[model samples]
Target: MKKKGNKPLLDMLQNIAEGLGETLSPFCEVVVHDLRNPKNAIHGIYNNLSGRHIGDPATELGLARIRDPEFPPRLSNYANTFPDGRKVKSTSIGIKDENGEYVAALCLNVDLTLFQSFQGAISQFTRIEDGRVHEDLERTPAERIHARIDEFAASRATTARSLNAADRKQLVQELKKEGLLEIRRGANIAATHMGVSRATVYGDAK
Candidate 1:
């Protein structure tokens, strides 16, 4: 162990870890490790996601940095796992002293379990059916049928309920040919719009 007394640098890293942990709250774990003391390198831990405590030994990466001077100063978005196999995305940053010796590290670990579950749910919810009818959900069948009748009546200079017998018979025949009289409760719907009995609408449709 180098056993350097760089309390200010370690304190700063701890402060940063605390702020970041609070900002990302309950999902991220931020840890500050004092590399000079390999046996008890964990100086401070915030959010405590991995269930590690202060005074824990240096991690593999931290130990590597302590031994090898040529190691990369930063590793970002690296894949990691917790003790129980929970997935994690981690970033490890090695802090160096003024003499260019590795002094401390600030690490961030983000728990991705919740986000992965959410992604799966979203994918399932948005899955498209391969074969489905094109449906008009904005209007009911009755409203569309009434609108069609009103359009047909307007062309004859009358309203749906004011059509003469000959005109009304022609309307029912045209509606039947268009399959409008084949819908559910077709005769009743036609009667309501034509101001006639359902039997009259059915008879006219034939």
Candidate 2:
């Protein structure tokens, strides 16, 4: 039989665990099933690259390890979730056994409810939706812009010779600041503009 004092501690621990599990149920579902769609495709391509799966041999080996089971441990995983008319940020961690083998994964989904509201308020205050300019959130915003400009120039059967580097960068920066980049136009945009595999773009973006 358990001692009276120990019984209380056990009860408290159980309660805490249950509470945490309840809080994270939605996020866990998304990580395992929802996020895995793209992840699996990425793995398939990587496997093909390593000759573990049958596919075109022309596949580059650089990205082969992304799907490798032997890939290094990751501390956390991040994804975005849209639920109840709000967007939430989700994070998940791998649960490991005593011997350091992964047993299962535990996830935490946080609703950035307040932050989203705060952003809206700030946007209104600064009249960002108006003709005013804004800053880009992507770290490589300038590079991304340059890439987009190059693609646009090429599609028009022209080159960057028509637009200076500064001009192209400015256009990209302006587009980013206006939140135009966040709008999703499906897999085609990512594939055409970014030169990334459809799987990678859909998986991460979805």
Candidate 3:
């Protein structure tokens, strides 16, 4: 049972949830559960990503809290997927009354479909292992070195000039893999174009 002053805290959290949902917009869903009544525990739902509304029954996590007195105060960054295969990253925070018993919970679910699409695109474009020869029969070593660097930056959705130290190191590794680093003065040309010293490239090569 909720204590006498529990209503005010729950109401405050509900208001905070409403503002959170509004600020995060289309990608985030926020749900508030009133554990006092598990059958219709949803005090409010915002963004509606899951298509659940107020008066909806408590979710599995909420029910677990009710059953286990020692349930964690917060559970965060867990994975959840919808019926449509939309992926969600979620966090649940349990709220307690003055008696230290769980009385409510605030849950946030963030849809990762957009991010997943970007990840897939990155994987497709960055792949260099097609088991085919890309070496130009007539191109000079300098031209091939520059071309490889440019390709590496493009695959990562960035420009070679804007590549950071870490990016340059990775590029050097890829260059070594493609046998460009074995060419005479290949390391010097790469260092010059990449705005890094020859030693930096060699250090990364190791």
- Please report the candidate that would top TM-score against the real structure: 1
Give the poorly placed runs of model 3, Cα more than 4 Å off.
Answer: 1-4, 126-206
- Can you write out model 1's per-residue Cα lDDT over 1-206, one digit (the tens) per residue? 24556887787888899999999988899999999888999999999989898999999999999888788999999999988789999999998876788989999999999989999999999988878876757877798789889998999999999999888888899889988888998778989988999988878877
What TM-score, over all chains together, does every model reach?
A: 0.63, 0.28, 0.59
The worst-scoring run of ten residues by lDDT in candidate 2 lies at: 41-50
Better of 1 and 3 by TM-score: 1
| Every candidate's lDDT | 0.90, 0.41, 0.88
Please rank every candidate by lDDT, starting with the best: 1, 3, 2
- Stretches of candidate 2 off by over 4 Å are 1-77, 82-85, 126-206
Which wins on TM-score, candidate 2 or candidate 3?
3
lDDT of 1: 0.90
**Candidate 1 weakest lDDT stretch, 10 residues:** 1-10
- What is the overall TM-score of model 1 with all chains considered together? 0.63
